[model samples]
Target chain A: MSEDDAVAGPTDDGQLVRVEGFLVRLDLAYEPDGHLWVAPPDGSTGNVRIGLDPLGVETTGTVAHLVVGSVGTRVRRGEPLGSLEAEKFVGPLVAPLTGVIRAVNPALATPRQVVEDPYGTWVAEVLPEAWEEESAQLVRGADRLPAWFADEVRRFRLEGVLAQ
Target chain B: MGPEALLETPARPGSRGSRRAGRTLGTLRVLDFGAVSPVRSQSLWHALACGVGRGSPAALALCRPAQPYVSLGYHRPLADLDLGTCRRRGLPVLRRLVGGGTVYLDPRQLFFQVVVPPDAVPAARSQAVAELLGPARAAFEAAGLPADFDQGELAVAGRKVCGHGAGLVGGAVVVVGNLLERFDAAAAAGVLWAPDAESRRRLAGRMAECVGPDPTWPVDAQAFAEGLVSAYAEAFGVTPEPGGLTPFEERVARRFDRLLGSPAFLCGPGGQSETQLTERRRAEIWTVKVRAGVVEARVVLDSTVLRAALVGGRLRDVVVEDPEGDQDPGVATALEGVTEGSPALEALARGGPSAARAAAAAARLLARARGGGE
Candidate 1:
């Protein structure tokens, strides 16, 4: 779909804010570097799924491909999980939680999965070893996301990286 | 990149977030492997880069690629290059683990590699690139060239004199750059994978324009190596200890040699259909030169619509060419929300929660259309 017609659909699982035609998830915690967001550990699995928020995806432009680590690979928080090569920028997909990879999403088989529903397409599901410690380093929930996301949008716009 | 991308600004010294690591590891080891064939030279640096670790001696390498070769970045696609042309031209295609665009390597350019502890490098990529290339920039200036480090490049009068790459290896960082006495611009540009000769000419012309002019021939490679050594030594506060590769390094380099030389590695993931990124698509750019000010932006875009103007750094004015009555109202509202008094353009980069992403994207085109930035 052309990017102009690719607005975010109504989000059912989380609180959504409509920004400039894109639906941004505000309920999840975002990492400091801006590309990653972590949902708090779900009760049954206690695994936090990591994904990209809409604003970050917008700035990165169209992702041509994704290179991610396989399952069971132990990853450190803040280290690179994989590199995303896109038309506009090439950068690392940083991990949010420090732990073993319990699962990786199958949707990312196509690069378009990322463009379609950035927040919905989790790259990896990590079983965080220390949620209290790691989540403390994250900006969680609606209270923190608005300012952070807005600031990021502003930063990206001035950085001249926003996709046209 | 357009002509505005060539405008060189003075380096903001010390802004590159990295300072002299100032760690004295007793002595710096100079691994002056004078010359190797194209493929081996690349492998040699890869081996040394991976060998860098905590307390590892600051190892420096100087070498020349004995023949011409085109090296691709680790994740870049092979489809971006015309390998048939490369084979016909006898330029072996190779890949580097470092990430970036592809480049041409030949015997005339002197290669320099400096490996240091990763902690000594800044966490920010831009800062680290600035900090690590700082020494090389100093060397070029000391050599009586009017040089400065801009981004990851060392520039002389706005043309690139040095191109560089950096990566983490075994908990250390190895930063590399080239000292060029000459470059074959036509040949360098000619190898790109373009369908038509005209496209190649346009691209090659741009690439040649970006590179600094060739230096005088009969250049002193040894003296140039000395300049790099002195700069690196002073940066890290270590003494130079002349040495060759030990048995272990040789063994390691041998492994890298085979691994890097294999057809699978050379072809890389881009060559394989399973791992290939998108085939290259040229953007269709149309510029609308409005008075609103923002300058110099280079983007490999997914959009064919980029209306850029070269203006000084102030983001003021909006021309929403919405002939269609159906264009979203949020876009106009978002543009109107930018307050008059802000320290910089970044302050206007965002809109309220209800703003559309299209507004931001359009504003980016507007901001860049007017040539102004920090």
Candidate 2:
């Protein structure tokens, strides 16, 4: 485990302590509107790994299949990098960043397995176009994440998409 | 406002509208609810539905499967089927582009596929099921079948009469389901690659009990399909308009139709070769816990031919290879006297002429029970 994967220490105030409902781990970086999370890339490798956020997994039923574009495929922001099929829905795994796909987890056995270990299963690794500039726009750190995730959960609940 | 909303729901067959109104948004295009081959009825609709998610307005298509075919969901394991038997029977086993469990489709089922933009679908999967399937459920009711979309299963009259699956493609949500006029429960059980006959029987029985289509419901395929059009229009608040497939959709569907027809389509790149089935007969022993003592049976297969029939652990009722008749009672008694993994069972395989072959076949049947470990 790298330093980026470290869990935040408990502060005396408890202002932004961990609360789980549509899990928002403080360790991962998230795209604001999309249901995606990215792991910090080490200096040695330029590829940044990405996976579906908890909310994204919960909103889609049993994932039946995962299909990805070929390596070296350049994807525009919001374009489909691949697709995830669930029992009741089939949706594109939209690109969270404008980048060339560096690698996809070739070992991905079954799409349904994502339900068990979502965070650990990185769908693809990409050479980010401008993550340095884009990271600033993402919802990161313990301070802002709780509110953002809670708001999304509430929106989903009201829309009759998520259970209360 | 969506393209369909700004323009009249049906668009009046090329009637002039505002520059912005030309986009598809409010109206739901209705396709002919006619019977088609399994490809056109199932996978083709899926390919078209996914294509519509990109930019076009939402649409619905309904059809009945013209012939028998086994379809697996995008992620379903092909190991769930007896491929050799399917092949021998001229059954085309297809892995559907959509996401769902494996199913057997024949003329008795009416299939409906719906595609809508991402914005139209709720953000939650559960809500989307309720929202999208609500129209289908209402349609079933209109067809004289009370229905509810539970999880991914559609139950009519408290039993599963329909199986539903959905997915998102190209920024759109696609949901598909069927209205069963009748179901071949035994054949469905036989084709599935399950462990023991008990489980397969349970599956068939439970499916019959919970999900199998009602054979008694007077089926009027065309009339039932028309009911769906009306229900969907009301449920989604769209006007049904007579329309045909767009040029782009036709091209996309045609491309995928050919792709879906390929043999490789049934087995993904990572799929294992017809894993458990060996060339010659492989004897496999399968034991299932029933109300009685542990009921064990041996399914002997020489390639696709069923060499022995020891279903439900009753040797008195012996069926030798695709036959439903009685064999010698003395042979059955000898087979029953020997327990699994015993020396007597091994001796039995080499003992008599015909009976000995069956005895040896039982031991080989053990492999299938353990799950295709060829």
**Number of the predicted model whose DockQ against the real structure is largest:** 2
lDDT of 2 by residue, B29-148 (tens): 888748788777765575566567556668888788788888876655576677767887777787665565667788888888887765565555555656677777766776777766
Write one digit per residue (lDDT tens) for candidate 1, span B1-374: 11111111101111111223444456778988887988678777766654655245668888988888998766656765777789899888877655456778888788888776544654334555566778776677655565765433577655677766655543456677788767777787677665455445544554555574444524455667778889888987878888877665667677777766577766654245334324333422222111112222222233212122223432323323333224445444444434333232243235432232334444555443332111
Report the C-alpha lDDT of model 1 over A19-134, residue by residue, as the tens digit. 44556677678775645778888999999898877765665555655666667878777665665644312345666778988887877656677777787688889888988998
What DockQ does candidate 1 have relative to the true complex? 0.05
Task: Give each model's whole-structure lDDT.
Answer: 0.58, 0.60
Q: Write the per-residue lDDT of candidate 2 for residues A50-126, one digit (tens) a residue.
A: 88777777766555466666688887655667756554344456666778888988645455446666777888898
Candidate 1 Cα outliers beyond 4 Å, as residue runs: A1-36, A41-48, A51-66, A70-80, A84-164, B1-25, B215-220, B267-278, B281-374
